[model samples]
Target: MDLNVKITVLGAGAIGSLWAVALKQQQHDVQVWTRSSDSEYSVNYQDLNGNTHPLLFTANSVEHLSQSDLLLVTVKSFQVEVALAPIIKLIPNSCLIVIMHNGIGSHEAVKALFSNHCVFYATTSQAALKADAKLQHTGNGQTFIGSLFSANSSYNVLTEVFNQALSPCYWQDDIMEPLWKKLAINCAINPLTAIYQCTNGELANKNYQAQLIQVCNEVTLVMRAEGYRVKNDELYQQALTVINATADNYSSMNRDVFYQRPTEIDYITGYLIHRAKKFDIAVPVNTQLWQTIISMESSYHA
Candidate 1:
């Protein structure tokens, strides 16, 4: 595989747009395959240096997808199956598949669907948000990626490609640990932020401490039951670190609920609750948060 690979971003939201621009800047053949349009699209991006520019991308049609060397899926967790199902056959087996999203469990379906292909799961702390039609690059955090199906897959070429586009991207032998850890952080922050309708920093207040502790403890229990090495206090501390670091920001779930758009709750807390049931572990705190979010979504979606 070469460094300059033809890539198609499956979703053109903030993260997808960020990668599309980064890959294009690295001189990769990048196109965006979007649900809304088949025409050329442009992303209004604000780079880390406070530079604002328009990054244009061609529409990734079926023919373009067949020649694509990579398909980067950045849709919301619940949208993954639907978005990929329609184009699975169009994407060539030679194209690498990278699923990067907020929550987990969607990869299971993707693994089954693309069983023969090399599927990878990645977690990134790099933060980007859309504001008034422009994508803002906030945090330049490290990205960890690993193989989901092809354990013997060589990632040197892919790693280099990503590093050129975005520094500090590493390939991990076991991606699940980071995935679970990120899940713990999200479980502690996202839903609670939405439930309380507050910024991430507010969660650091003493009033929210008990809720945070219980959420982390529940998630830690499920994580341990699933055989991941984690501790309740560690998870809680990680969440607090993120909250304090991103004190002024509202979580993705908080924005989703505020805007009445679909959220990845089904994949975040919902996934945790499902696994807890499998292990017969009770996650009352998570269950409550999940139910509250579900109720809110239903009320608006109904």
Candidate 2:
């Protein structure tokens, strides 16, 4: 609730545009940053309520070229490095940075870049899509912000700001809980959707149901072995609920494959495979799905 809190949102993608409008609605000093250029950019978005918002976001091409109280890293998972590398060394030691993106591992990378600053890993289920400068708000979901381990006073302040905005934002004392849960869900659903080029609802049919179960089972085993204490039956059921809830929606991976763009297969199922290796767990289903998506991505450029 600090008045006139300067907020710089990194990346001008779907989620980035969504947050820019949300923060702007709350009347905060806002700016958007993109690696391609270092100037103001126009962001247009349509919300879940069918409200279209268009605004010129004060933008910075270089991360270190501008200073803000809060720096939100909202770039695509794969583009994190290329976007932040030029300015990582220039980041102010006192700036608070939040890494908000799909998949895992990006947080560790960003934290390393801002080793001396206030850094946190955050995840949001709020789904949005972007094409050029246009953004479509697909679904409204909760966004949880958390530190690598525990939250502090600054966490509370940022959580309050997000809560006061349009979406429900919570501070997580143990971020690993949500992080693992999302990873498990993505492992079970994302790759298959990409390979099949189908919507979430399509996975419920007989053709894909068994495969879904197999992926979920493997993910459950890996998660339990990783010390999560999650049960296979419970995990499978939760995944089914997610599929049904987002039935008509095409997953990010699915869209990536359909559009011939690079997918985050490595971070989703690949992350599970990486963790399973540590436990010496056999995740055959996940492994196959991972390799399959990798093949799919290769076909794009070939």
Candidate 3:
């Protein structure tokens, strides 16, 4: 299929760079927007066979991004608003905005802010990190996408673009389920790993297994009370499976804590705690994890 779409990736972080490089390789017109006024963003592509190649692309400013046919947002949750504010006027109302973020509430937040455009939520297990201006693709995983409502013709174009450029796009009637499911996994593993300074494998030890279950339980309760059909047992099993599969991998939150960068705990566990209060559901475990991450941030600054 011939891809005539002009794609712009905001943030130019690990995931953003990964998508930009992948799309560019597929023969699409791809550009990346970065906060860094630097002339170029470096990206390294690594396949499943362990081969790597480095490439550099020019970084465009927000005002120049308005002409893109599609915009993939990969900014940290906290930076979303600030990063897009100056460029909001540049985004065409007809352009599709795909937010491939890791936490809950991003879709709603983006939808509220960009009411005129089509906002879609996407989730992927593809692991990546930035190093020396290049994005390192660490692990391979599939991506799921769906509209906030039912399927539209636009989604057909999106699925085609994703399948050709990124691959393994699962279309769903309701994307919220997978969004919250991924959020449950993040709430269970990210904070614990960040706080304990351990990899996913370390959670398998007896000392951390029970705490892991508790975190999953807290997220499950909040999700269920919020009208999502997530069970504690199922979420716990999913967390365990992820821990075993990515045993040596350090989560993004873990990397943030290690680098003294701000973590996305507020959008992950903290979002659960905030919603639990609205539903009169108790989420002490998640609340504690939220507090712990906040304390870590305080200490990092201190």
TM-score of each: 0.96, 0.93, 0.94
Error of 3 at 151 (Å): 5.4
Q: Which is better, 1 or 2, measured by TM-score? A: 1
Q: 68-167 in candidate 1: lDDT tens per residue?
A: 9988999999999899998998988888899999988987789778976888888888888886568998778888889866574477788788888988
- What tens digits encode model 3's per-residue C-alpha lDDT throughout 181-216? 899999989999999999998899999978888888
Could you give me the TM-score of model 3 versus the true structure?
Answer: 0.94
TM-score of 2: 0.93
Model 2: ten consecutive residues of lowest lDDT: 58-67
- Return the TM-score for candidate 1, rounded to 2 decimals: 0.96
Query: How big is the positional error of residue 223 in model 2, measured in Å on the Cα after superposition?
Result: 1.5
The global Cα lDDT (0 to 1) of model 2 is 0.80
Best by TM-score: 1
RMSD of each: 1.4, 2.0, 1.9
lDDT for 139 in candidate 1 is 73
